[model samples]
Target: MVAVKITTVSTRLRRSMRAHDDYAVRVGRRRLLVTVTAHPGVARRWVHTTLWRHARRLRSVDGITVGMGVQWTPPFRAMKYGAEPRPCTLQLCVGHRCLVFQLAHAGAVPAVLRRFLADARAAFVAYGVRSDCRKLEEHHGLKVARGVELRRLTGMGNASMERMQCRS
Candidate 1:
């Protein structure tokens, strides 16, 4: 097992008012250091300085792993028909790094992230990718140009990767 280190980017900002937090996590040979931020500037800087830099060294065969979750605005709200839930988080893992973006706090998706998702050379791998792509476009106006559905590749049903692996 690897240790995880977490630290705040700005000590001057109050805990509740801080825009983001930095996390340094190690999993196997991967070193995932990402800043969870809703600020567009911070997110763009991270993408250009860290994500794109790392992506340059990766081969085309090594694709990015994507995951996301949706949440209701009101925590205890009853489900309403035809209402679309907002995406709360988006996680992008590639090579040795993984970035987790707090979408609920971000008023709009960062241009850098949108560019990444639209990059034709980068292949995103996720379960239920079509649904994820649709939700992203509908809510944030972000388009995913290319992606591969893990379920289709593996011939798995609705079960997640974790649950499927556990069964095996």
Candidate 2:
């Protein structure tokens, strides 16, 4: 993903307050919120072909790169015993579509999904991407060949802001 240097500044400021959330613009990643609810589904090995068909329709339109994220609870000692663990939720945002799917088990991935991920590596805009890509590869065998790390790009933005303020 190409890094755009310009900051999306707003002059019409409104005072607001909010609690501390990981969703806040952290120093490392710039995660945007999804206001609209994401559609949900489950990934089953038997449904790999079905999943691939679904994935092909994911990037139907041109020029818009896909944005994706995952939510999951780490296995703790108390939750580790004799019970089915909660599934990891995968969130995907394409042009005008949003989807949330629970990954039942890893490694039964669709080929088209893998291809979409590979394409996203070069085209998508996402936050904390390295670990996300790693998780995709480690858990689902999807390798992201190359991509822009927004942490670095946004770090540059911060640096530029400070420099401008100092001059002002």
Candidate 3:
């Protein structure tokens, strides 16, 4: 498994961050806390471990909606010819942090991520989310896809789209 991780290079991710905190992401608008991932590495393993470790807390959300975006590469674009197109950049937003899952194959997403996403949908107070459940299942192999559109409560509206960055 290649694993998946989210780094806030776009939006502001901060929580009680210190001036000298190595894990701190930024200063000012960004609190720069390791609140997102525990291990704080440039690898997806760390993200998986952190989320897995805190699964209980994550699943306990009153309501969680994730904003998602898709990207198409040269190969996909070449075949598109203005076709319906396919998904590439899979971005998911919870609060201030956006977890951009740059899938090698959107349809072939890792089982663990699918599991977490499903759990988040079930636990979060997304009872009011009106999403394309059918489309999500057909394309992403999951019952629900979370995002700013998914989250009417605290998402950055359309800004969420521009703010989310593909974890490089």
Candidate 4:
């Protein structure tokens, strides 16, 4: 038997809401403070500090949880004719902090983000991570040097898991 943990974050925004917001998300048994923003500066600062903190603590950064949302092209006549999906949002979670970047509003991808993604020492963890990395490369020219796919780790194939049970 195997046990897998998953976390989800959700929030409703008003019509006149600001570009940045904070929410508490539960990851496993801990509550994480997540910041959602469309500003490149804020995202860069957070990633910079996070990498610095991890470097000072362990000399290497790893176990970064990553998730992304894509805007699919409209389906008209045939599925094959539809344009490739465009990545809209990227979310990263580490320790008690999570940062959600709205890529559409962020304009260009930040230099810090590019460096972070390209860092070989930093391992990004996600389900179907290869596709995520591919999208980043294809859309933003960002290369992710290392990543760990949870689906492969758990041997779960393409099945979605909300809650996993383990037998000891």
Model 4 TM-score, 2 decimals: 0.72
**TM-scores, one per candidate:** 0.70, 0.45, 0.44, 0.72
What tens digits encode model 2's per-residue C-alpha lDDT throughout 25-89? Answer: 22223334222221111222212433354565544653335566756677776654554334365
> For all the candidates, what are their Cα RMSDs to the real structure?
6.6, 11.8, 11.5, 4.9
Q: Name the TM-score of candidate 2.
A: 0.45
TM-score winner: 4
Question: What TM-score does model 3 achieve against the real structure?
Answer: 0.44
**Clash pairs of candidate 2?**
none
Sum up the clashes in candidate 4: 0
The true-versus-predicted C-alpha distance at residue 15 of model 4, in Å, is: 17
Using TM-score, rank the candidates from best to worst.
4, 1, 2, 3
User: Least lDDT summed over 10 consecutive residues: which range in candidate 4?
Assistant: 159-168
Model 3 spans with C-alpha error above 4 angstroms = 1-28, 31-47, 59-68, 72-83, 93-98, 105-107, 120-136, 145-151, 154-168
Q: Which stretches of candidate 2 lie over 4 Å from their true place?
A: 1-63, 78-87, 105-107, 120-122, 153-168
The digit string of per-residue lDDT tens for model 1 on 22-131 reads 76665444556656677777677767765557575434565445443333355467668876676667777665445667787887777888998887666677877887
**Model 1 stretches with alpha carbons more than 4 Å out:** 1-17, 28-30, 54-75, 155-159
lDDT of 3 by residue, 1-168 (tens): 434454445333344333111234443356523333222132244337647555576666544434444444546235535443334445444444444454443234566656655664433333223343443555556555343233344453444423332212
Show the lowest summed lDDT stretch of 10 residues, model 1. 8-17
Q: Comparing candidate 1 with candidate 4, which one achieves the higher TM-score?
A: 4
Candidate 4's error at 76, in angstroms?
8.9
